[model samples]
Target chain A: MKKLKLTVAFDDGDYVVYAKLHYDRAPNLIAAIEKVVPFSNPVRHARICESEWMLSTPYLGVEDENFSYPDPGDISLHRAGPHFCGWYERISPIGTTDIFASVASEDLEEYRKKMGRAWEHPGAKMTVDIVEVDA
Target chain B: MNPIAQELFETGDRYLMERPEDIAAMRSRMGTRGQNMTVQIYAFSALGSSVDAMYLLQEAVAKDDYDFDTVVKFAVDWLSTLAPPADGSQGAAIIGHRASVHYRLDQLADLTSRASAALKQATTRAEVREILQALEHYYNQVRTWIDLEFPWHELAVKYAELMGDPAPRPAP
Candidate 1:
């Protein structure tokens, strides 16, 4: 099976990072995310969970699957706000989440800086879409 | 110690016991069916209002000399307003059946207790402001829980009058 990849672009593609979909662990969530690829939304910082960006996805209808504490660069779907979360920096576990993808390790630093900016200056636009890549 | 700070400390201590009791009583009343959804709606309104109150408090603290006595007085007054009258007046009642609410309130008690102790030691405006900031952080945690637990738009629609219209108020 070909592993899926997602492109996360911040500020209208000014900063871009690649994430690999966890097809094995969260196949259903991955499928749900696929349907919404090429999506754009405003991103905000999380209040409880430190060093993370929350992308509102009120449209998602998936349930919990493989929910657990996230490491840096992990992307997960949190059904409460129905937020698509991106953890760019190490964060303490507020609660478990159904992770579907993770940013490339090499891109973690830049991703951390971009997501951290939402703390000081929120309402930045983030675009997500599937990308052709071998992982 | 400033008299206002002393009063705030006392108020905080009172709330550590009173607020949770109010909610627990509300939960008991709710279980009896003596009260209706109106009580829960009012309780939700109280929770919603706290978010606004925190924001206002934050603004007041931003000023260098923002009248500490007035701020303390407001804080003292607002703490009481969170609970409905135990006598069940004005069609209001407190509501908290979910263990999460009780647990969160316990966490809130810790913050208040810390704030009260800090009140005794804080001699400078900056110190007081820091205490307020800590309170704001705790409020934010509760706000997050509320957001996760309840749908504000649905609540606003169902209890339109109690929830108040979401008019565009000027930013604080």
Candidate 2:
């Protein structure tokens, strides 16, 4: 039961943004996401079953099923292509997603709007850090 | 308030009342016949080009800009588009909806790949953001195609078992 951080840095590493993970609620997705910690990925705005902002965590091993629609500020991991995703708005994912974290920004809405397409930028890369919060 | 949003709300309210089983599907696990509401929503999401309409509707809800009639109309436009599965057979829309969801998923993956490639050619935050926003606009196009079609899975994992497209070891 811990919160992980998804930190994104782009513009030649001049910019950085952090999203907090909510693993306590979703015990199913943590292991898959953790194995590829400190991995770099670009964000994609996915719109299949539902359109939402998603970060990629390719080549991870996980098989947790907690199918649910995530709201804004929720971070989720789906094994379908091993996607490490976050929600910036109301759109849902195509299938079941085990939500493991969230962007722990004070103004989540602002963070979402500012980082809208930063991940899609070729230079944009995110490093997810698995941190345990104080109990 | 968009007129469509209003229509969507009335339809959803009426549908929910008449078919409690659809509500049950959302609350608990059920078969395709029980998932009429879920399929409709899924199709609606596929029909939408982007999350912008939901975003706008959310904004309206938060700001009290949306009235009762305007609330649900934006997402349930699919209700109007679905016919009785052509030959009036069961699971017709369910199969169709599954296909719609898969197609949209494929389309999104392709768009992301293409956008990333374009970003490679154009560096800088502004250029990258521009490309992403363009993709967003495309995602937003789902709304106009209310006339267009759109799964199951809560029916996918069952199939994912055959496709081996999902994860092997999930969170414990």
Candidate 3:
């Protein structure tokens, strides 16, 4: 199955939090993310793009209704859902660097607008990268 | 170590043994005369209900936190008042089937108690393993009985699938 990688950066002083995402089962993964993200209806914002076969949740301040991308595969919140929605991929041929470039190029303008001053800061970085991994 | 759990286990065991005898005697009194389809059907339904109660008792014991004794006592008292007195016309075949089910239910009750005790004392991997083994045996036995008794039931097929057993063959 195709898997996505996500690298998120937030300004909480010295420490930067990076999350990688992989959802083996979409429904369960959606439930897990909802627990962490504050949203009225998380699933609706987190749309599954059929064309790219990727799952995406809205960024913290993104205003667009249809800016869906592949989900960043992270599973730190084990008890967030009924079960684990991601597993480690040992033989992922797709490099993270290439996927990161595409996501940055495609969504950088939206990311800048939403993040404001944080987007321009040297440390202000958030990435949503998709990488295909051996199932 | 809830007193209720032990009480439920004992009560369930006693019912399994006593109820069948009561039904059998009622069958004898009717002198094997009338068909009494209503009584026969009730006896069959009671047998099925008792088996279900036994399984629930096992589940309560497995859960270990519930006051199973009180739950079981209430069930037994309710069943006693609700079940119709056995009529003598009920055939031996029906009685035999009920008896067998009661026996299995009793065995399951015993297994549940033992398994629960093992779980309570399980501080090590080996102890957990032993408890799991006991549970597995109990589950397999119940699954086999259910599959045979209700081959056409959708839940039976679902159970078989969950256990990785082949779907039951269509009734011949």
Best by lDDT: 1
Candidate 1: tens digits of C-alpha lDDT, residues B1-172:
4443344334433332133343444444342346534445554455546545654664575576688767755653454344221222313312332222332244344344445445444566555654554444334334333333333334445565565756321111
Interface RMSD of 3: 26.0
In candidate 1, what are the lDDT values of residues A85-127, reduced to their tens digit? 8888786887888888887798887777666766655555566
Q: List where candidate 2 sits over 4 angstroms from the true fold.
A: A12-15, A47-51, A92-95, A118-123, A132-135, B1-172
Residue A106 miss distance in model 2 (angstroms): 2.6
- Candidates in order, TM-scores: namely 0.44, 0.38, 0.21
- State which candidate, 2 or 3, has the greater lDDT: 2
Write down the DockQ of candidate 2. 0.03
True contacts kept of each: 0.00, 0.00, 0.00
lDDT score at residue B56, model 3, on the 0-100 scale? 47
- Runs in model 3 deviating more than 4 A are A1-135, B1-34, B78-172
lDDT of 1 at A69: 91
Compute DockQ for each candidate against the true complex: 0.03, 0.03, 0.01
